[model samples]
Target chain A: MSDFQFDKIALIGIGLIGSSIARAIKLHGLAREISISTRSPLTLARAEELELGTFYTESAAECVKDADLVIVSVPVGASGAVAEQIAPALKQGAILTDVGSTKASVISQMQPFVPEGVHFIPGHPVAGTEHSGPDAGFADLFEGRWCILTPVEDTDAEAVRKLRSFWESLGSRVDEMDAEHHDKVLAIVSHLPHIIAYNIVGTAEDLETVTESEVIKYSASGFRDFTRLAASDPVMWRDVCLHNKDAILEMLARFSEDLAYLQRAIRWGEGDKLFDLFTRTRAVRRSIIEAGQDIAEADFGRHIRHEK
Target chain B: MSDFQFDKIALIGIGLIGSSIARAIKLHGLAREISISTRSPLTLARAEELELGTFYTESAAECVKDADLVIVSVPVGASGAVAEQIAPALKQGAILTDVGSTKASVISQMQPFVPEGVHFIPGHPVAGTEHSGPDAGFADLFEGRWCILTPVEDTDAEAVRKLRSFWESLGSRVDEMDAEHHDKVLAIVSHLPHIIAYNIVGTAEDLETVTESEVIKYSASGFRDFTRLAASDPVMWRDVCLHNKDAILEMLARFSEDLAYLQRAIRWGEGDKLFDLFTRTRAVRRSIIEAGQDIAEADFGRHIRHEK
Candidate 1:
């Protein structure tokens, strides 16, 4: 606990991340009253139908009024707008945070619009599935996941600590990193991977000789893995590409360079080069499993997992 | 049924595919006697210990003697050597098949050495897990998966029918294609994906800016999906690259072109361009699910899957 129970928690965008937060909060009984607001009226009604919050509204301003913790869970491009609308309504000393994938741009986008008395701390929970919307969330989404908080320098230490505790209560292990560094790290780990997945799937679909049905039929051999990532929410990923432009470009450059090297190896019949690269990557998967980040089941246990 | 019982079945290379076929055959009680062999003594011993077959041998020749069905499940690179070794001992009119990824290369390598009366069929069962070896096999590995056969024009129809029936009994839907066409199709669907996955994982590992631990900690966001493909057998991927060079290079060139276009879009802040591509790719994923090629569960249903 942050020494005081959160009287009311306002979720400013009830999408996958926001709805998951609502579920987790309700499951743990962490909030006295949960307020959820999204710009889309249909989504707001859906949130109400899902019983995701005690208060549901389409007005971002109405969602944050009198709330002790105001969490903005919108696209990076929409963050500033939500912050601007909710700024005047946020209760004094209320914590303001976001669950955006990118951190540095998010801080810049919402930081200026944040009211002076509100303790604005930027947080990104490194968790989600390809599915989106209010219906796509679950209470355990954040469990055993890493949530990185990139609080600005000169921010209140008490606010950072309490925010860290808040995420910890939500089943996340929190780590602190500079916002710029966080962007760079996520560029390689998250943004670049998503971009690459989208690009490859597009490439596969656009092929002239291979039929769509054949690609689908044989996807289990390998291509199916990329589709899961490519299926992520388009708007969210578009904002990610736009907001973290520099870092993502840097990573794309590196990935292209590596791909060129690999292409040359394949062209020249350099089996050892291909073998060496392939062999080295197996270790990374092993490390991820050892770190308890992934399940060790073969074929991701897709065969057995489907039974349930 | 094939109109005749499989009197004696021989499996060469008791790795993941080989052992899985062994299990599937046993599960269906499709064969009267099963013989397993691998060049590696330890793996052969493991198959024996696992009760994968009624007979085990170190020599491919000895393993296939008088066998009515012989399956070569070794790495694609090993297809030639196994076919040569087993040719002399194979029974007349017996069905001979190899479960190699690159059908053209496997056909080229094994077709010459195949005995005249033996039906040499090159097939690829588009199913497997990242994990390899005998212990990784299970009866259901091929269930609801596609198996592509690329048989030469002069091959016996009855033999091909029997082989198709065998795979059907093992729970695969069979499709026939020309060897060159099979290469091209798999190059895009399977080969290119694994190469890109391996290349990206290698690039992430080689980076100095993002610590390896950081990549591991946050992999679930998107990077983990690639790791599964990257962790696939090194030698198998190497052979795929070498064997299907032209088709793979073509797909790689197209993928690189698409990636460059995407990179430019990101650099120029083309949100609509990025958004359109991201949204369009989601449809392919939907098609894959509708085709019954992938589970529709979010994040591959990884959370619910872990409980078991």
Candidate 2:
């Protein structure tokens, strides 16, 4: 059997994820024709400059006309607006999907606008760098990563399978889960970490005693690791916070409670308590390395080659 | 003038820092001979197997006897114990220094036991990995990294300069700060981050809703970055928490306050507030990269070569 191929693929919001999908499709020859669209004229021009697609347009509706697949790669907060704009132009029986970090909110926002025959499968490819825009993307962004598809009940089974296969062809390991579960899982893993990183960096920046230069100079000591996540695209993260408020707030509550316990342990000079907690957390990192989710080298394998 | 060279060097506690110092000394030919000592016989044996130093001993006193320089690279909690054990055996006019994370506690712990003529300068080389022990050290570990020295008020200026040069020969950029300031700076830059990482990982592991395997699988989303710091040596971090209690507690307070503000913003769906904070923090990462404290590549420059 031949691999899945869409007659025309419409990619809305040609930012990092959109541009990456464009590159991956081109590299794999997964689409007969690709159309790129973004509201910003500057971004659309950049996408054209990068040759990310055969057809480029500033209109989302124009980009989706006659397209067999529509991948909405915009921020979560923009999902409703994008879906509303493209609804009239969506082709019948087309597989419509998204690459938003939050699933439940995106599903609710886009579901009303998705045409009757069009399949709306919410997805989150659990991969990214702290970079955004067309130049920040590459074809192999999804390689060795998990792409989660959260299809709502009563959706077409054939559409789900086709979407899964398409992602697999792009080098992603595809998995299916409920939208609510996906949101909860991501709340703890992705959203909470980013928030903590931003908050810590902000804390460091606001300190009167510790100068910004000192924070930068001594950052390699540990603080620099958090800065990478803190440096992520603000708009996407802001939409994530607005869209997945409940789950994120729950995770934040748990995180703060745990941090309070740790602070108390330090205040009371409870060395054993601190030691046990620290030791327990180390095993998780080992498991991540063993599972091939992270590099096995120490210090993320940076600057190790020069060691004598 | 030639750089300062020791006729014999004693490395008390053959862990990551000690072994790295041993290798740097050998690589740069800064010492004629190196004696290694550790409380753990197993670590001492491993140091011998690695040939980290010329002489291996279980006795700190024996290791320091007649040595021109003695470096105590133990947990901050053990500073006083090591100092008391090796005081009488320290050679006259020999420079005694440490590579502990905290300076004020180390200085307070080791100062009373210092002999009249021996120059004791408390130092913290702000470079390390999540790994520890003799096998984890490398000769170039200190290259382009900062080593902060907190010398006492009455300490000999010549001895401080000599110790500073010794660290510089090991490929460090050395700076001098008061003990209290060093403790405060490190508490924010290093200790708090590790503690926060440990706490968040602990919280995730303890969550009833999220399976451990799920966390291991989806770590790349963001949580994995914190795990690197969280996976650090339990004993070493526990010692840091106890020895630098006041400064660490202060930083924790500031961190928690900032996190609370962020949490409230998320709860209220304040996109602008979230966006503003996230945007502000990105500059610090840029500053760190500009300072050469961290690599400019995304994701700490790990596994990017395979991306197309």
Candidate 3:
């Protein structure tokens, strides 16, 4: 147990998720050496300035050379490109994982470039802030959050266990599932909600009757909640929208259909229908709270978090 | 300054908003006597158990008798009936107000029943938790928040000023606007967001491929932000939908239109279009944070608010 540290760990793409993993690795002393790389030179410089890694490189290939663990934290669409860059450099028996939101797509994108002995496990930390970039990351970003790993059938169980333990060391509770099932689950829980949020905030911005000032001033009413998700990284979410197209479109159709039903009910003065739906959703909130997914306090505990 | 408080204040509904007002009044000693009334006997008994007022009664008329201030905090649909019940007993020169989300409809619902000398100022505190009921309120609910007062043109100037100061004392910044304008503003800022939240949550719950249990388990990924708004008081939200029908419907139409455009972009693999829209929306989020309407921390500062 005392010798369970990695000889070398490499991080490709040092955005919020990547940098967070780097910080967590440093804090827990989980690795003998941390190699960090990102496409943007400015970001690499910032990462070095922040002292987030023991080794900094702009080339993904150079950074992952001889590394024991390699974590790719890029947009889903960039997974393949990054995987191709670092494939030859990944050490034998090294564990390769990603923190992409969509598992099936990332796995499919990154799998073809994988070396024979490298274990490619697709994982998503299921955690984030609306903010992005290296500076936005923190050590506790993955603390107590669910980190899901979707490995193919032929993957080695020992390699999977090692990757799971790595995430656990970062304070994550890990779950294992198939990639397709993970995509479907994330479509409802993550992608659809983000798309809805982005769409609604876009709608508010285009409103002819209500000024943008009014929306911003009174946003605490509810619109502000959606804005947080809407503020998420564009390139990442766009990739999610494109990669998870079927699932999202399915969700959008169902959500629109449900919304249309609600619209008709509102038009026809069907208070009972509205009341029933609203009440039912409240139970879902309570369940999330009970499951420790969300806080039980009112307004997300704004009064306490935003104490003036 | 000590003598500026109301001699007696009557609160017609003792739910979240009303009870918060009761607590704030007690904390600030803003009224010589606080009289509370609700149509439900059980809630009245509970308010008594909580000792929220100097007087408790079931009769709205009896509650408002001789009160210098009357605040009717019931659902918008019930505003008319509450006004009718308490009008005859309202003292001359009394300042009357409400905390309904919709302004124009509430003013219409409550206007005709107001006595000639009673100043009926329709107001919305623009503050709340998703939780409801007498126990789900606190004095800090209104602190650093905005309270919009939609006083009709014929409302007395002194009465408006007095109501403004009263809300200010409770730590609110008061803004005066036309009732119709207030309705339009709230339609975008509050009603549409909540309707969309309720609609999406319902959609997730009714999913065929994705189980409700999965949504509950993985909800921390964006879906949970929405469940907060969806968990709001059902009856109150129902009333808001019915009374603010036109504005809400209009905004819903716009939102759906925008969503269709987004869906098309997603389906066509239009990354640039998706990225552009996503990027534009992030600015709205920054504007909201800058306006001091929401907390700047990530995930609504959930980490700080929900410390494990």
Candidate 4:
């Protein structure tokens, strides 16, 4: 209790990210009190059943009234509305932040409604699974993960440091970047991948030649990887795509042009071109593993050890 | 060993798949003697250093001369050349099989060169990582995975059963399907995914708007999964794209069409369509997990438990 940083932390959307933060806060004793709020009563009841927070409220305003820190974890598109709803109730000195994937858009949406004296920092913890909702969260979800904060100019240094330390307490290595740059980088890395995965899986679903059952039976190849990403929360991804349209379309155009080149190379039997690109991509995977971002082996070593 | 199935097993082309088979054979004591052969001297020396076999040979002809079982594990394009080299040396009535991804291409290439008394059963172990070479081989690579056999009608029944038992010994579930069907199923499941992955990685590589370093930094969002798939063996995958051109092209066309629909949906803000497809793809992931084809979490939960 002596190590706890915040007297109370209010989670405004008790879904995966919000519940995960709640769990981590509870596990690490980061907050003395945790308050939860969401739009739906069913979800709030479920969160209460799980005891994800010390207090449950139907009103976002009520949830944040006395909280020292308020985290808005909702779809990126809904940030403006959430911000407006909670703006009047936010404590004057409260450190306000968000866990949205698209930072620039979220900043735009949330900045207009942020109350004076509240530190409004937008963030994205680049960690999640295909699952969503309160039931899908775990305490260690942020362990060894990266959480990016997009703090605007003129933002209070003390407020930013407090939020950084809070996330650091949850086992996350924090990085700060401009909101626009964050959106652009995420477009290439996260947004485009989700869009392409959704597109490919949708393609397979609509295929007349390849049966759905057959696709399921043989997905161990490459398709399953796309499926895992595509399986991400639908509303969340749709909002991300809609909100980050410019960055996404730019990345998409680049991706399509490169794909056309590859298609032609394969069509023309230009094996050298194909070989070079394939060889180069391997180094990137090695770098990722070396960076501790991902494991090198596909079997993930766990199943291998279990079998042994 | 009393439980050893074969007195000797000859492996041609000791690359990733070939070397993995050698390791599994040794670890399980499935073969009393393992003879390894590959065309490249450097790879052969490396295999020897790794102690992958009981005997090492520069000539495929000499390697299979006295072996009870011969497994040709090489790129699909090289199947014919290796088959021709080993044809005259194959022991009479030896069980000859291959672990090739494209069954039709392997069968077409090797069928003519297989001696009359030798049983040439085409097989594909639907398990692998992006990494290659003899050094990538692991003893438990095939554990709890799938092995698909495409046996001709005239194939010897005893040889098929024996090969099935051998794969089972390595902890792989064995199933049988026709050669052409295997190609189509693989085209959608495995081949298209690799092609898409390779194409997307290439797309990201060529982007002028987004730097390569940026793509690499933010890959965990989703681009990284494609990198893993794209990083797979180039020669092996290039051959797959070439050999299964018709099916691959068909799947690609279907994929592009579906992508266009998704792009249009996004452009028009069609949330329902986007949500529907995303939800459906999530179900496919669940099926894959239930089928025991993949870890329910990321790559068998390696990243999740790595720190522990």
- Candidate 3 residue-wise lDDT, A2-74, digit = tens: 4637989999999999999999999998988999999899999999999999999999999999999999999
Lowest lDDT block of 10, candidate 4 chain B: B299-308
lDDT of 3 by residue, B1-308 (tens): 45748999999999999999999999998998999999999999999999999999999999999999999999999999998888889999999999999888888878898878888888999999898889988998899889999888878998999999999999999998887888888998899999999998999999888888789878888999999999999999999999999988998999999999999999999899999999999999889888888888888888755644
In angstroms, how far off is B55's CA in candidate 4? Answer: 1.7
Between prediction 2 and prediction 3, which has the larger DockQ?
Answer: 3
Clashing pairs in 2: none
lDDT of 1 by residue, A233-266 (tens): 9999999999999999899999999999999999
Q: Tell me each candidate's i-RMS in Å.
A: 1.6, 2.3, 1.1, 2.4
The TM-score of chain B in candidate 4 is: 0.96
Alpha-carbon shift of residue B173 in model 1 (angstroms): 0.3
User: Candidate 3 lDDT (Cα, whole model)?
Assistant: 0.91
lDDT of 2 by residue, B1-308 (tens): 44539889999998888999999999999988899999999999999999998999999999999998999999899999999999999999999999999988888889999999999988999999999999999999999999999999898999998898899998899999999999999999999999989998999999888888888878889999999999999999999999999999999999988888888888877778999999999999988888888787767766573322
Model 2: lDDT of residue A215: 92
Summed backbone clashes in each candidate are 0, 0, 0, 0
For model 4, what is the C-alpha lDDT against the true structure?
Answer: 0.84
Query: What is residue A230's positional error in candidate 3, in angstroms?
Result: 0.8
| Candidate with the larger TM-score of 1 and 4 | 1
User: Which ten contiguous residues of candidate 2 chain B have the minimum total lDDT?
Assistant: B299-308
TM-score of 1: 0.98
Q: Write the per-residue lDDT of candidate 1 for residues B49-74, one digit (tens) a residue.
A: 99999999999999999899999998
Clashing pairs in 3: none
> Which regions of candidate 1 are displaced past 4 Å?
A1-4, B1-4
